[model samples]
Target: MSPAHVLEPTYDTLRRRLLMGAWPAGQRLEAARLAADLGVSITPVRDSLNRLTGERLIVSQPGDGFHVPRLDEAGLRGLLDWHHAIVTMALGRERAGRPDEFQLTGGDLPERSAHLFASLVARARDEELDWAIENAAARLGRFRHHEAAVLAEADKDVGAIERMMDEADSPGLRAAIDYHHDRRRSAVDQLIAASRGGQII
Candidate 1:
């Protein structure tokens, strides 16, 4: 297979793992170890790591290897704020036309939440905006499971968002989006603490 073919799967697998909080924040990633685990060569692993670093999913030091980023309170809050802003913008654009249909696919709240926001952004049909929202979602993915613990009836909130999307209720959707993000923003400290404690769901 070509190098790109070899690298694509490795990159995707690593990205998924990172987004899913497979490794704890701040833990160093060893290319060799990951290569062995994935049954690939170190070159592909290193290349994948570099790609993730650029995406801000992995942090790279000058002399040190790549590591999973640790989202502190301020950092997490900033991401949430940025995500909410762009999502709000996307919602505005989407409202200009008939909202595009999207299917939510995930077994858990975190995955469902990510898919929900992604669907919202996708409806806007702006590549740049889509990229922005997706990046934020990836960074926020690890902490989403904590939402279940911190926010009451988190699943209900997601269900409501889905319902609004289905009914094309733009105003209610916007309000629900605000409420969802605001609730998470208010509980950032608790979310970060739960993540640090390695509590998933």
Candidate 2:
């Protein structure tokens, strides 16, 4: 593994802290502060923040610094809806056709996984209306690191889930949905646990 692998875990740990209301919204991200806390360089922190920005978990302000986005009811619902819609659409048998093989072999991943995550992020960028609402309580300064971590896991599962997705006619879609949802729920719990450690809040 590369040296970067050691730092990758920081991204998820940081993102969750921001999401769980530890930092709140509209706060500045001090690179020096994070470096001191995480015992890493500033580069990783900056990279982590950029990743979070794509997720709409944090907003980047030109002069005001990085802010935890403000998410209202509609905004939160929109993200939740988008997540459900995309997962349903791509994995639903009715839409994507026959199921591909579900494979999670070791080694390099395919481009499809990157594409799906990018698409989810693109939906957020296309609109500012729902951007801040769902992530309102996030501590933007903290989660840049954690975002990277989540993306890594999500990246790994993306292709397998898409390939395994059942056609509407098949009985597999429901099971796939349940399987993916359970994984996501576990991730959420891990996020919450990491966030509430009182480092940011």
Best by lDDT: 1
Error of 1 at 160 (Å): 0.7
lDDT of 1 by residue, 45-64 (tens): 99999888999998999898
**C-alpha lDDT score of every prediction, in listed order:** 0.85, 0.49
**Clashes, model 1:** 0
Question: How does model 1 fare in lDDT?
Answer: 0.85
Candidate 2 vs. true structure, TM-score: 0.44
Give each model a TM-score: 0.91, 0.44
Question: Stretches of candidate 2 above 4 Å error?
Answer: 1-7, 19-21, 94-201
Clash totals for all models, in order?
Answer: 0, 23
Measured with C-alpha atoms, the lDDT of residue 126 in candidate 2 is: 33
